[model samples]
Target: LWGVELDPTSTDPRIPVVLSKFLRANPGDFKAAETSLRSILVWRANFDIPTLLTSEDFPEELGENIGVIRPKDVKGRPVVYHQYSGVDHKAAFGDLDRFVRWRVQLMELSMLQCDFLHADSLLMIHDYAGVSIFSYDRYAKAASKKTISILQDNYPECLAVKLFIHIPWWGTSIYKLVSRWIPEATRKKISIVSTAETLSVLLTYIKEDDLPKIYQ
Candidate 1:
């Protein structure tokens, strides 16, 4: 799809194996198999897999606050957890664009790390604890909008679930306002949990050890 041959033998061994499994499972769905393979190839090209793995552009200063932890299997899919709080956001991401780029890199890295598990999607956990009026300032909002756009536009159909936890009452209003920009299909994947019990209930898909200590 991206000037790269899709031959399984000549390229990555996993590529052909995954496609073959998909075709076998579908049985008489060649179009669907081709579309799925094309999407994977396109994602690999646009994500620039080699560059991301070798590049030192994204420094530790930019990504220290964010983490790509162990994957938790949910509904037979490997779910990667991305934990972030308002404090971490303010501390690490001073420049919006830099933060966005770093975030994208982190996602790409996570995808590669979990590729062996055959995970096609990810689950995000956004811990909004300690968020206040200051968090919704002009710069923060603008940055957030841009970040959302990048995720929704560039990485399509990759989010299996998104959990917004510890949302304050004031934050809820701001969230509703910002959420208008998100597509309905994507928005449906988000679940806002205010109470610890509720968040726990939602996180039942993941194992206790896999979850962050704060959530536990």
Candidate 2:
């Protein structure tokens, strides 16, 4: 575990307030709240977020069809778009470890952009139109699990909503299995739209011009 310290005077004032609220909401679960807050701090340090923002590794990821869009959502949250079809786990990344590292770097970059908008959360759109089971092979599956774990455990309240569009029937079963790994609160924010028409639901949170052509 990364070293975690609670320095009141040097820390963000809002953090303590959030921590207090978490403890209050959880009642006698002070230990759980403290642990959760500590993990957030540890992730901040261990993620090497500042280095990722300036690192050249980011351009490769962005060029590979992973990026944070310029427009903020209706609520001012940043939007992170992923083209699942564009990703070739073995051919593009070579191995699971490398793939996961690239994913973590990309996530850090997106989170950095979110910070500039004074947003703690982000809206994610994963386009699975052309993706197939081949894309979800063992390597990709392992990486996806790790990615979800990082997001759910370390990132803490950073996901505002997720729109999974163009999912096939086979993909639904995979999503059902994955849903079990996600927290209920986060699961509630996830929507799986089977057709392009149902994508209108996203317009409520994202503007038409802001959406990519495929979703529009």
lDDT of 1: 0.64
Local distance difference test, each candidate:
0.64, 0.68
Q: TM-score for every candidate vs. truth?
A: 0.71, 0.79
Cα distance off (Å), candidate 1, residue 44: 7.5
Which candidate achieves the best lDDT against the true structure?
A: 2
Backbone N/Cα/C clashes per model: 0, 0
Off by over 4 Å in 1: 1-5, 8-49, 57-61, 76-91, 116-118
Which digits, one per residue and each the tens of the lDDT, describe model 2 over residues 1-216? 111224666565445534553464346988887887776667767766556556636335435474445578988887888777767566544565556666666666565565422555678887788888667876667767877887777666667789887888787899998887788878888988876545777788889998777667
Q: Candidate 1 versus the native: TM-score?
A: 0.71
Q: Which residue pairs show collisions in model 2?
A: none
Alpha-carbon runs more than 4 Å astray in model 2: 1-7, 10-28, 56-64, 115-118
Q: lDDT tens string, model 1, 14-84?
A: 55544554475346989876676566667667767567557748666565345554556555454555444
